[model samples]
Target: MENTRVLWLYIILLCHYHWFFEEIDGLVNLALKKPAIQSSTFLNLTASLATDGLIGTRSTKNECSHTGVYHRNPNPWWEVDLGGVHTINRVSVLNRAYFAERLRDINITVISQDKTVTTECAFYQGSVAAAAWATVTCHPGTSGRFVRIQIYNEAYRDVLTLCEVVVEGLSPCDAFYFRKHPGQRLNSQLVEEIQSNKPMDCGKACFLTTMCFAYNYNSDTSACQLLKIGDPCDTTVSDPGWDFYSNCLN
Candidate 1:
């Protein structure tokens, strides 16, 4: 009877561990599936305000100098570098509340490594009204790193003004790591620390924290140090018995 009870307890512990691991995995998958434009790399804008403004994160109907971009040119264009290649799901553009008609005949293009693919990710054909946001979704999605928006040939030359640009998709770092980054210490902004028995336990801790991009686990001490910035590609030698997991963009 004692042996049977022991076996039942062991099974219960195993089931609990499995459930915990699966729950964490599900959360990570949900994060990967969500739209991630707050971290996008803004490029080829007339001013830094395009990126520094509320264009990506907090765009709204409010018309202010700190809310959007104003570019001068008949053929003004802008691009967003998603930092890494991603399976793009959709792109949304919010026009300035004051002069949204300036965004007309805009063409959206996705640029990959060797080729450029055109996408039908725009909702409006002509001009979107002021204080309105338009969404363009790519069916089945497309893989690209750079997404460009251009003001094509129109009868009137209009300056480019954008309240916000949002890009949604799956990230290359959704898998989150390329094995344990051996021998390197990811010394960035320290977030937190916790006791972990295995390297994978440390990885799960890092995955749960939004700011934890990397982690260094000491196998000897069972110490897990979470870091704000780290990349697997940037490997460097550290002390012995230290395994690192890096989820930052390459």
Candidate 2:
């Protein structure tokens, strides 16, 4: 029951009202939330997205110098440039790399044009991957600008298969992810036809149809809701979706 509750929590985080959506493998979108005051971001590792579709693969950069990969990828280290957000409290990263995964020898640093700080936090709490939905929070002792999530060493691969990367508790800049719609429509006739008959798995419906950015599921009434999730990053990752998008049909 606890596990189910956590899963639901994760699904809720994936909703549009409070998240920033990014398209990866196209199987399902890589869903996540902006840094909240006290909440964590939802990430998935069971998927990956390229130009073609979704696949279960990691990043590997061959023929390189110190810019290497434990598993090797076209590049190493997936960094989300927090841009210019000054006040940030914590970072929640979901590790779903499965049993054969490990994020060893990692470094969590706070970087800035003027001020910077670094820590050997790779030994903070987790290993390379999170078997379940694990939470990584920051403490008062850990804070800075240019928040760099670097992989200095890895027990496994430098190419990490991350589902979502959320910077919680936004202090200045505006950043978020989530969907509150059924899907993107072109015509009123097409839209009306959909509102008449909804899907059984509304949460998972949108992603499968390739129309939805995010979705909303009412727990109590006929108030069906969904929305479009916006993108915050340029690079895409392929991971599976736990949330569904509903589609109504004639």
Candidate 3:
């Protein structure tokens, strides 16, 4: 009876909102955000736009034939640049409905600008049915500016296809902090102040408030002060022991 009740509660939660789960630092973090890839700015991994419609936006298409298909003699790949480095948490890939079987044994690699590569799945053998979406949670601390889908068609060399690709992660615009300026405070209004252990904790306080766009934190004093301006650094003066952070999104 207890198990049945808990299951019903879970079902209710699932019906309300779409949820993506990821394990971060040994803790399961719920991802309620959407994909971060910019469809219009995406570039073909190799092919020209005329030959291949491998635009990242098409990956969002529900049907099969709308996907981007890549065909070449050797290894064919597609990637989307997120414009900036991000703390990537999850990657969802939708297989083409028509010949989903051609995508077997593909590789998904995420690379940062610093040349750091985090391979989400190597030689992934897709056994899922056609038009199915597969989601993979990246390792903790996984981050990159570019997400690449490399398909080495060694079998029949038919073609590599992708219906859609969604990258879920903490973008730089989502959260960020700047270094402390010695002896300087900004003209940005202070909204609130609270005790915080780390810069991230202070950032969370700012993120929770709609009016807060920036914050100042003192690591030694554990003081966190949320600011009202979008960019605190613009108005800040030299201040020691106080680090400034702001949401680049604003």
Top candidate by lDDT: 1
Number of backbone-clashing residue pairs for each candidate, in the order shown: 1, 48, 12
- Candidate 3 Cα outliers beyond 4 Å, as residue runs: 1-72, 114-123, 174-250
Residue 16 displacement (Å), model 3: 21
Q: Write the per-residue lDDT of candidate 1 for residues 1-250, one digit (tens) a residue.
A: 9999999997886665554444321112112212223112223333233444354422233321121233224565556666666677777666766555667777777777444665544534688777677777666666676666666646434455555666766434434342456666765678998898877677767766788877788888999998776444544468777877666453
**What are the per-model C-alpha RMSD values against the true structure?**
15.1, 16.2, 11.8
- What's the TM-score of every candidate structure? 0.44, 0.36, 0.45
Q: All candidates' lDDT scores?
A: 0.58, 0.36, 0.55
Q: List model 3 lDDT by residue over 130-195, tens digit each.
A: 767777777777766777766666773434455556667643322232333434555688898899
lDDT of 2 at 32: 27
> Which stretch of 10 consecutive residues in model 1 shows the poorest summed lDDT?
25-34
Worst 10 residues of 2 by lDDT: 33-42
